[model samples]
Target: MSSPALLPLCLLLLGLAAPVLAEEAPTPAPETPAAPAAVAPALERSQEQQQALMRQLPAEQQKTLQAGDESFLALLMPAARAKAAGTVVLVPGDGESADWPNVVAPVRQQLPTFGWQTISLSLPDPYDPVVAIEQDTAPADTDAQANSEQAAPPVTGGSGTAPAAPTQAEAGSGEPAQAAVAPVDPEAAANAQATRVLARIAAGIDLALQQGASPIVLVGHGTGAYWAARYLAEKEPAEVKQLVLIDAREPQGMPPRLDATMGKTDLQIADLVHAPGAAAQRRKERAAQKANKGYRQIDLPVIPGDRAAEQEQTVRRLRAWLDRLPPAASGSPAAS
Candidate 1:
C-alpha cells in the first residue's frame, strides 16, 4: 500500500507546518549584563523663585533649604543602631507646608522634655515613592528578634502592664473603622503621598541615628496620617514602634492595601481627629480596636471656643497621650 509519492507528500506537509510552529514560539529578549548608564537630566532651574524663597526666610530657615540635595542625602544612613529610645519625625497635613518652620519649634520643644530627639525635614516630593521606604527595616544585618526584644518595655511598676484598648469590629456585621476596603489605583494621590511619607520616615530614622536615638516614631496630621498608615501597612518593620495621627482626615479611599498591610505587633496606631463625624468613626475604631488586640484609638472632642481655646484643649489631650507612650519609641501611634 506504500507509495514513494505518498511519503514525499507527508514530508512536504511536515516542512510546511515547521515554519508556523517556529513563528508561534516567542523569541526571548536579549539580556544585557550591565546596568544602563544614568543620564544627567536637563535643569529647569527657577532662579527667580529660588531667589525669592531664599530672600524671604531668616538666616537659619534659608540655610535649611539651601542644604542642597547632595548634602542632605549625605545626612541619611543605616539606622539599624538607632533602636528603641529613638527619635520622632513630625509631619503636617496636606497644603500645610507653610506651617513647617512654625510647627517644628513647638514639637521640638515638647519632645526633648520626654527624652525624644526630633528631626524636622521638608519632604516636597511626597508623591514619588521610589526611594523613601527606609523607616521600617532593621540594619541590613539586623537581628529581627533582638530588635523586637529591645523595644519591649521593662516591667517596672505595680500593675507591670499598660491597659490595652479593645479591638475594632469585624467586617460586614460591623461598621467600617479605618477605611472601607477597596482597590488602590497605582497612580492615585494617596499612593503618591504614601510614597513621600515613606521617604520622610526614612529621613526621620536617619535623623534619629544622627541624634543618637535608636527606635523611631512618626507623628502625622491629615494626609500625613494617611501616609503613616500606608507606611505601617506596606513597609514598617519591627523597628518602627509607634504612629501618632493628629486630626487625621477622611480615609481617602485607601483600604484594601491597608487591611493586610498593617501589623499590630510592630506598630501601635493612635487617632486624634476632632471632626463631628469623629464620633461615629471613634465608635467603629473602638470596636475595631477591641477586636484587633494590642491597639488603642483615642478621639479627643474639638474645643467649643475660639482658636486659642481650641489649641489649648488639643495641646492638653496631646500631652496626655504623649504620657501614655513609652519613651523614645518610633513615631507610630501609641498614646503615652
Candidate 2:
C-alpha cells in the first residue's frame, strides 16, 4: 500500500528495468547460408588469353567484327602495293591467335607486301569435355575454400580456436553438400561453335566486299582449313576465287571431314603440306579420287629448329602460286 505519488515513481522504475532486462538477454541473430560456388565457363580461359594477346597487337590493325550476337577482334592489314592484287582472309586454328607465329602470321603479314590485303579472324575453342571440366572445377575449388572459411564458427573460450564447422551428417542432413554445376551438352556446344565460326567468316567476307577488295581468297591453318573449306562448300559465295590450306586438320568430334569438304568445294585449292605428314597424303589422295582438277598439292620441307626459314619457304611458294593466277576477270571489283 504505497502512496499515490510513490505509485508513479514505482511505475517509472519498472519501465527503466524492462530495458535493462532486455539488454541482459538479447535475441540470437539468424544464421546466414553459405554462398554458392562459382562455376567457370568453357570459353573463359580462351577468351581471357585472346584478350591478353589483343593487348599486345598493334592498335591500328585491330578491328571489332560482329558475328550473330557476339563481337570478336580481328586484324585488318591493307595491301602494301598501290594496286591491290586481292584480299586474303586468314583463319587460325584452335589454341592459336590471329597473329599465330606459324602459317597464319607469316602468310598474313607477308602476303600484304605482294599486293594482297589480309583479314585474320579469331575462332572459338574446340569442345573438350575433360579440359572444360578441369578448367571449370578450378573456380569451384577456390570458392569452396572461401565458403569453408566464411562458414567457420567464431573462436570461443580459452582454446583460442574456432569451433569446427558442422558436417552435413552432424547437422542431421543425410546427403553431402556439393556445388551444382550445369552440364554442358556436346552436340549443342559443337553446333554453337560452328555457327559462330561461319558467321565470322561471312562477316569478314562482307567487310572485304565493302572495301572493294576483289577475288577474295580464304587461307586456313590446321583446323582453320576445315572451316574454310566447309564455308566454301556450304555458302558457295560468288566472290571467293581460291583457297589455301596449311597443314589442314579437322577438329575432333565435329562433322564433315576435311577431305570430304574439300572434295565438295569447286574452287582452286593449294594444299601446302609440311613433309612427313601422312594426313596430308591421305587428303591429296581423296582429292585425286574426286578428280578435282583445280586441286594441287605442294610439299614444304620441314626445317626443324629453323622456323623462320620454313616460313620464308612457305611465303615464297605462296607468292609464286599467287603470281601465276590469271588477273581478276573483267567484272571483278579490281578491274572496275
Candidate 3:
C-alpha cells in the first residue's frame, strides 16, 4: 500500500532493525561434548585391595584389568619430574626370572625422600627390540685363526698399560677355585654390547647433569657391580663418580687386572659382600686369596629367603649403607 518512494525507506529501516535484533540474539553455539577427562591408568585408579586381586588372577584369566602396575607406573616418572641430583640404577642379579618390579618398588618408595632419581632398567632381553649385542668379539690384533683359537678372549690392558696373563681354572694347580667353580676365563667375555648399555647410562648421567645433579652415584647390585667396575675400568674411567658393589656374583674372582686397571683411574671400590660374620669371614678369607685390593665384608643380619623377606632385606641393606657411609664431599651427590 506504500508509495514506491517510501518502499526504499521502509526496506532500509527493516534492515537496520533486523541487524540490531540479530546482534542481540546470537545463534546458539553448536553443543560440543566436553572432552572426556583424561583417565588415570587402571593401577592408579584401583585401591591396594584391587592391586592384590589383580596379582591373584592368572594372566590368561584376568578380566580386562584396568591397569597393570608396571604399565600404569609409567605416569610416575615422566622425564620432566625425573630430575635427580643423584641416581641409583638397581641392577638385578643373574637368573632366568628377572624380577624387575620387586627391585623397583622399594627403591621407588624411598628414592624421593633422599632426593634421588631411580631408574629400574630392564636388562637386555634377548628378544628385546635392541640390536643383538655381541658377547665377545675377536681382537683386531689377532688373525682369524688365532682369534678362533681364543673363543673367550682374555682381557688385556687397552689404555696405555702392561698386558697380563690370562687366568687359568683354579683347580689346575691341584686346588679348586675359591668358589669351587672351574675357572672359566675369570672375566666373562666382555660384552662389547654392554658397551652400548654403558653408553646409554652415560647419556643418562649427562642428562642428570644437564638438569641439576652434581654427582650421579652408581650402585650395582650383585654382578651388576662388577659390570660397573668393568665398565669404568675399560671405558670412560672418568665418567663414573662412586661405585657401590652390593655383592659380586662372579663365580671366579674379579680378574686381578681390574684393580691395577681401576687404580690408574680415580675409581673407589666398596664391597658389601654377601654376609660378614665368622663363617662369612672364612668365605671372605678364601675369597680374598685372589683379590689385590681391600674387600670389606658387609654383614647382612636378616636373610630374606622368601619374597617378602628379600624385599625387606634389600631395603635394610641400602639404608644401612647410606647410614654407614662417611660424610661425602660438600655439594656432591654422594653427600646425601
Which candidate number has the best lDDT?
2
Q: Please identify model 2 stretches exceeding 4 Å from their true place.
A: 1-43, 129-184, 329-336
Q: Give the alpha-carbon lDDT of every model.
A: 0.51, 0.80, 0.45
Residues 1-336 of candidate 1 have per-residue lDDT tens digits of 479779989999999999999999999999877966899885223323334445665444332322223222111112233333356666655544423433333554455554555554444433322222232222332333334334445545586776333232222324223432343344465555555556665655555545555456667766666666666666655556677766665344444433234443345666665763643355345537547543556666655656555655555665566556665443433422
Deviation in angstroms for 274 in model 3?
Answer: 3.1
Each candidate's number of clashing pairs is: 40, 0, 0
lDDT, candidate 1, residue 204?
56
Instruction: Summarize candidate 3's per-residue lDDT along 42-144 as a digit string, tens digits.
Output: 5322234334535753443222211212221111222224454455544443331122345445654565465555543333322211112221232342333
Ranking by lDDT: 2, 1, 3
lDDT of 2 by residue, 1-336 (tens): 559889999999999999899889978999997887899766655576569767888888988888899888788899998868888889888878888888888998899988989999887766675654554554554444545655646668786877766744435654345564655666666788889899989988888887676778888898899999999898888788688888888887788778778878767889988863677877788888888877889988889999999999998988887777666531255554
**Number of clashes found in candidate 2:** 0
Ranking by TM-score: 2, 1, 3
- N/CA/C clash count, model 3: 0
TM-score of each: 0.49, 0.73, 0.44
Candidate 1: worst-modelled 10 consecutive residues by lDDT: 70-79
For model 1, state the Cα shift of residue 58 in Å. 6.8
